[model samples]
Target: MQPPADLLLPDLDRTGAVPMLRQVYLALRAAILAGALPPGARLPSTRALGRQLGLARNTVVAAYDQLLAEGFVTGRVGAGTQVSRDLPEGLDAAAPPPPPAAPPAPAPDAAHRFRPDAAAHQPSALPFNTGRTSWDDRSQAVWRGLTLRRLARPDPALFGYGDPQGARPLREAIATHLRAARAVRCDPDQVVVTAGAQQAIDLVLRVLLEPGDAVWVEDPCYPALRAALAAARVRIVPVAVDGQGMDVAAGIAAAPAARLAYVTPSSQYPMGVVLSMARRLDLLAWARRAGAFLLEDDYDSEFRYAGRPLAALQGIDDAGRVIYVGTFSKVLFPGLRLGYAVLPPSLLEAVRAARLLVDWHPAGLAEGVVTDFLAEGHFAQHVRRMRLRYRAARDALVAALAEHAPALAAEPPDQGLKLLARLPAGMDDVALAAAAARRGVVARPVSPMFLAAPPVAALMLGFSGHEPAALRRAAWALGAVL
Candidate 1:
């Protein structure tokens, strides 16, 4: 064995501008690279080196610590420190970087279809941004408390891998909440927790429909749902929406053999029309006869301004035809990204398996917090409080529209976040929306939302997420543009 003192380090430069620690580190690194200190050669202990160089022991130790971190040296108890047996390759400082190379193509599945769009990210405190919901201060404090409590508990499962089907306690709580509030027919075993309603929709599509297989979606439906379906590479059959909601008769006429139908029955997105009870029965009957499935997105059904929210389409579903999807994002907050699907016995395992294939499960910590919220009745309480706040904001928007822009036909929706305001006949809704955006408002044109029924010239203004004063101010600015 070579004695540690035989290692020849440079003389200490204590009087120079460079820190003694940095100089020590640089000297050792250079020695290792130049082969002055060969691989596996012993290094002097910090005390011995500091005494020889007349520097502090900490400076020498600091240099050795860096060398160890960078794989230039290794240390072990009793054996002391030595040069690394396997040193990491280092690039020559004068060498040029290699040329950029093209990436390989993605897999031939729906994975290739996804790309981020700004529409989901655009909802904000800005007036008329439809994807947001109003929040309260006290409720936020309560939510923070629940989250902290989850971390304080000493549970080993918190760090372990969780079930792909989601935590059983949270599923049980979600099942109970759905049964009581939306009248959904399911047990805890039937629910599969997901990142949000969007994931739940994607999972159902990939499992049930093949590429080019036809699926019926509501015209003027949620844009994100359409994006998911297109990403799955399935043929989307756009059915028109009437005052009664999705025209089921037109769908059957167009493609009765379609594998699935996605609808928001309780409150149609953007249009805000509840599916008539007669139509609901007819759709359910059609699904059973055709051996197809209906995905009921009960997204904002909890905050209806009318007497009470309507029962979910799943409640009336028999023959295992309905797959119910819902999210806690709206009532709690959007960032929570917690949503669930109540699957029929026929599709339970398939969806859970698809979930595993896509992403192994929702965050366990978030699941735990939601479970406590639902079981403690905090979820229901939060919904009740938000309903009143949203109603006030809705009223403000309606009054502002009528007062400021009378040419725009507007009506207050009974139970949804947005309202449809008809523009003057022959006016360009797209141009109008662009103008609104330039004026610091987010207005969505309704013409693009249509399937084929002569496009209606209208704009969709969201009301739930803005304050009354802010809504009024936005409406006044919107009037000037109109």
Candidate 2:
């Protein structure tokens, strides 16, 4: 069949980082999947396509070969190439075509609600955005090398459904790392690998909570965890946090019968307060008395700046009531989507069962690569390098805030990626964040982290993702907004 006169060729971005052949493949694949090219429709010959697109025939061949290998197209002698008649699932010709692309909509009103965390890491987005963790080129190169090595081995275990509690080797590696770094005490058998801390928290809540059970949450807690608890149909009692972190007595007074309490002990989220040892013991005692479990999010414990890093809450929990959760998102790259939960001996079987039913384990390839990362000493080296770099960034950020935004005050925490600055009295942090976002600086409001009316206005500014200079620039921008 002759090429359709109106068939639009894929637009290539010559300066883009994507390879030309891969771009061609993706465009053709999209056209086929979108029904722009009908099933069994003939594609131009490689030679013809190369000529039409003004390219070398080998480049066209490379694109066509990839499509053929992926079953997106088929070729035969004399018939040339055609869109695959047996399309992959959900790409059927009989399936309704997607609606035409809508024209770009007008920008919403300035007061329109926007999620501050969603676009923090966009290529063009502002720097110093909360929850944005940096992955340097060197680290990415290391990860790529590790990933290639894993792919070369072609493990049969990775090809099959992974162990629900996670790969044994990976679990062992995690246990060893936790033992050394965070002082978490657990056997490999007690660990359950999850698709990041979010899923880890979700799995724990699934196994532990019944409908409408009261759970204690830090007043200004991680929003994602709160959402998970709500989804599980649990009542959340928001307990206050101070310099000592979540007040155990306050939590007891708020929800004495609460079945579980989620706390970030090493470095509390949003507000970078390390739960004092006294408060840690107090919380543990409360949990024991109430016969409840503590979900300890040991997120970002690796980036301590000032003093020696505090031991994990789970380390001192002799009562076996603490479920220690940790993630590679902050330490490594967030896209890795790898995290683990160290369950107590009592809850191990139930959590494993829940994990099996929930996603049946995280991606085996990531688990395997990360296992190698931890075992081969790359993980420790990377963390040390990041710690130094982030410490510098944090110091610069604090200095900039003091110089530029003197109205805001923040004491640098010994650990974690973000610095929480208390806003001036009567100032609206949410509004300030919105304004800063409009001006291309992502400043997250601490108010939304609260369950009730926030007692004070605050902003959580991230420093780990940006360089010292970039952090200064973001700080200057934030000061202007304030």
Candidate 3:
């Protein structure tokens, strides 16, 4: 019989990686599965098919043989290969049916803490996004050069499984940087290099917290913290954040017996407020009395445009109550996914076990690159240059808001990559943010950060990753959005 032009045989790639016969078999199997070739439909003889496809008769015959063996097609001496009616049905019957979709099996008591919005901080480019990090030509070239050098002279061990606590040299470098720059009280031995601050958060939750244990988290908090707390099945007690950061008094009044607490002490997230020394003392006292641990997420404390300087909570805690979390995402870039937790000596092995269970360890080659970056002092130099650029971006954004969108009150931050822009009272900040996003500005709503009713309507504007000119253009477009 004469063959048709289309075997719907996917175009044969004679020069491709896959063998010709296997490719042919796959194409014919796909056609059968897709119902393009109905049951009992006759295939042309191997010789005729070979001619149509420009393949040798042997290759076509071999392809047909595979399909026959797989039961997707049938062949007899007189009747040429034909599509099998029962193949797809039989395959489906062999596999188990899919389960119905349902909510995740978080502890029933902690279900209320798992709000959907907490997990919604996705990436957006340009004018304002908490997720992006600043980078210029100088920093990019340095990073590329360092990375290429590592790739060229790879350590054989990098290809093998890595240490769960991360590479020893990287941990030592991180400890050195934290001690000098952030006043963190830690040594290389106590440091557990994590994928990022989020994984560090998850590691702490796994190692220390038990299901249904009450935990203190800042109200209007960093969403990722809230989500992680909930996912770990801890009862998240929302402690109100005032000008002094997380209100320790409020947390005590609400959940004094809480097992653990999470705080961004150096600079409160979203609001960019520092924890006053008085409040920090009070928090440490509370943890001591309650015999609880504190997670001090030192988020975005690096770029202080003004102030005497912020100290890490972990640096001050002598009682070993603090688990200090810091990330290179803000300083380097979010894609690096490298962070470290300065754990208490007591929690070291437990955290290591939890890290092993979670993801084994952070990527090795990146760790190697960062170790050199810190050891050779490129990290400090890069941070210094990027500070000036980020400061300029912040100023430009604030200025643009003043010029075009005066109604939105912007609090240009003295620290951190983002600032809070208050919307008019009674206005919906979430709706305004959605509108701004449509106009290419990633304005995050401050109201959604709160667990309950928000006291104010505002947007969080990030400035670290933009050029001054780009920030101005985006802010003007955002004004148009307004």
Best by lDDT: 1
- Where in model 1 is the C-alpha error above 4 Å? 1-27, 30-45, 48-55, 65-93, 96-112, 115-117
- For candidate 3, lDDT tens digit of each residue in 17-105? 89988888888887776666767778878898888888899998999998988788888887778887666444323346779898877
Weakest 10 consecutive residues, lDDT, candidate 3? 86-95
Better of 1 and 2 by lDDT: 1
Please tell me which predicted candidate would have the highest TM-score against the true structure: 1
lDDT ranking, high to low: 1, 3, 2
TM agreement with the true structure for every prediction: 0.86, 0.75, 0.81
Clash-forming residue pairs, model 2: none
lDDT, residue 244, candidate 2: 91
Go through the candidates in order and give each one's C-alpha lDDT.
0.87, 0.84, 0.84
Please identify which of the two predictions, 1 or 2, would achieve the higher TM-score against the true structure.
Answer: 1
- State the weakest 10-residue window (summed lDDT) of model 1: 87-96
Worst 10 residues of 2 by lDDT: 111-120
Model 3 accuracy (lDDT, Cα): 0.84
